[model samples]
Target: MKKIRWLPSQQDSHNRWVVFFSLLMGVLLDSISWSGDWGVAIPDVTPLILLYWVMAIATNNFLVTAFFFGLLHDVLYHTGMGTYALIYCFLLYPMLHLRLQIRNKTLVQMSLFIGVWMLAHQVLVWLITPANHLAMENIAFWFAIPISILLWSFIFLSLRVLRRNMNVR
Candidate 1:
């Protein structure tokens, strides 16, 4: 009797579905708008989710996926085309480059790192979108950094569980 060997591509296909669903959740969360000043404080979920996957899965290049999700966000929010696409791709670059090292960091350390990364994301958005200038001046805009930092553990743990349960490599 011969034993069947599981292929690496099979594992990657499974990982792709898991990654897609998680990123979809991030897009959905990002689409929700709050009223008044509170809206500004809403953390950017997609990028955080992207960051997690980039760190978790070392072999895949999520840049294209990030770009696709960004385009989806643009369409959903009716933003200028490529605004988010560029942001996501640019932000993901560093993560992809340092994913190996980042994977070893403690959650606390990673959260701080995410905070900095997200700050750059915000700054990039501010720079690219002129309409956001006023919002950038608002304290709530800055508040999002802390909010994202707080949510990091939750996102990390939940996704970690999901990845394990789904047997994603």
Candidate 2:
């Protein structure tokens, strides 16, 4: 029988800081509000960032990470407790399961998946919050999906470069 190790090794431990900072950046990006109605067009950056890290790094336990960050998001956004936490966990579960297949996909293919993913996230947010019920009718509400899809390549490439440069396993 094989045993599982929960703790990261000395070298692997360094990646935690990297992942933390990147997710923090995502949090920051998510918190910023765009001027006027443009805000609705901005996609949720944290999840996209989370998706990148989840797909890139296999060893780390992102479910807990996602939960924590999602909690942070809920607090930051002043939403109900466990709202984003539940959403993040729900979204990341399939990604965690299909990480290998997703990792192998080309950037264009990945963007399409990301579009669907973001759409789902938006839908989840709409359903979870009563305030967002009317948002679905707005054109900008749907803009988030395509905007996130466009950002996918940039996020993926930059994070890939960061991981490679940092030598994160």
Model 2 accuracy (lDDT, Cα): 0.89
Q: For model 1, how does the per-residue alpha-carbon lDDT over 19-61 read when each residue is reduced to its tens digit? A: 9999999988988888997798888899999999999988888
User: Cα lDDT of all candidates, in order?
Assistant: 0.89, 0.89
What tens digits encode model 2's per-residue C-alpha lDDT throughout 1-169? 8999787687877888898899999999988978887688899889998999898888765998999999999998888989999999989998888888988999999999988889999999989977788896787988999999999999999998998999888
My TM-score estimates for the predictions, one after another, are 0.92, 0.94
Off by over 4 Å in 2: 1-6
Runs of candidate 1 exceeding 4 Å displacement: 1-8
Displacement of the residue 134 alpha carbon in candidate 2, Å? 2.2
